[model samples]
Target: MLTLRMFIQKSDVISFKNMEDLYSRLNISKNLKDEFKSLISELNDYLDRYSPLTINSHEMRFEKLSTSEPNPDQLTNRELMDIYLYGDYAHLDSSKRVRFERIAQNNLFAPMGNHVFVTIVNKLVEIIDRAVEMNKQAIEQLKDQI
Candidate 1:
């Protein structure tokens, strides 16, 4: 899980769609708009099996922010990073360590099929890229104004 965390830290975001949606719904930041699109693309690519970003941490945890609801909980860019930057599914269960190891060793995301695994990888990458992009743009803009 710690490895995953580091992977996410080094990984970059380039989309602001989710960020913009959050802002529009919550009035957080209007500046993340343009960067969000690029982020989404970047994430989509990063999470792919061929991408350089991969899990490496042994101790990662996902912090539950709110009670489950019909609408997903709102996530800031940093919070979003927490999700992908953490452990893989089996990390949640110690009993599954052996099973998880098998999959990990084989580099197979799923035993039944690779499609679902691919989809998840893509999703995580997409989300991370989007958030990273928005955050990057905001930092750049701040630097420019200074």
Candidate 2:
């Protein structure tokens, strides 16, 4: 039932910076926390290694860029990926422009012409899906126990 809008919501993404924080927010049991931590660690490593850099509002040329922007420092990996996936980058600096071009080259026929961005976003979505499935399994177990 999760829509793209829901998945990319800034408010929803703000709570989780890393797996430990996510576990805390979900109130995961200590026993399962370790497992989830391992999975999250792997996902984090992949994101760190492969995710694109995000351009801040200051870097964006568009007028009407929000006066109340989300803290750049507070953005989660998924949020960062979302920005890279969806934000306009036509006005990026030289280095960022080069990087964006490389991404575009890799995705020549891609819907958005940004294969790296798409790959990272898909991975992030997978991580969220896994977390949701885990929560559902846990809830079902609790229901059975009751």
- The number of the candidate with the highest TM-score is 2
Q: Candidate 1 clash total?
A: 24
Q: For model 1, how big is the CA root-mean-square deviation?
A: 12.1
Residue 128, candidate 1: C-alpha displacement in angstroms:
1.9
TM-score of model number 1: 0.34
Model 1 C-alpha lDDT per residue in residues 6-30, reported as the tens digit of each score: 4344332312443544444532345
lDDT of 1 at 41: 56
> For each candidate, what TM-score against the reference?
0.34, 0.47
Candidate 1 regions exceeding 4 Å error are 1-93, 98-110
Name the best candidate (by lDDT). 2
- The lDDT of each candidate is 0.42, 0.50
Can you give the lDDT of residue 51 in candidate 2?
A: 29
Residue pairs with colliding backbones in model 2 are none
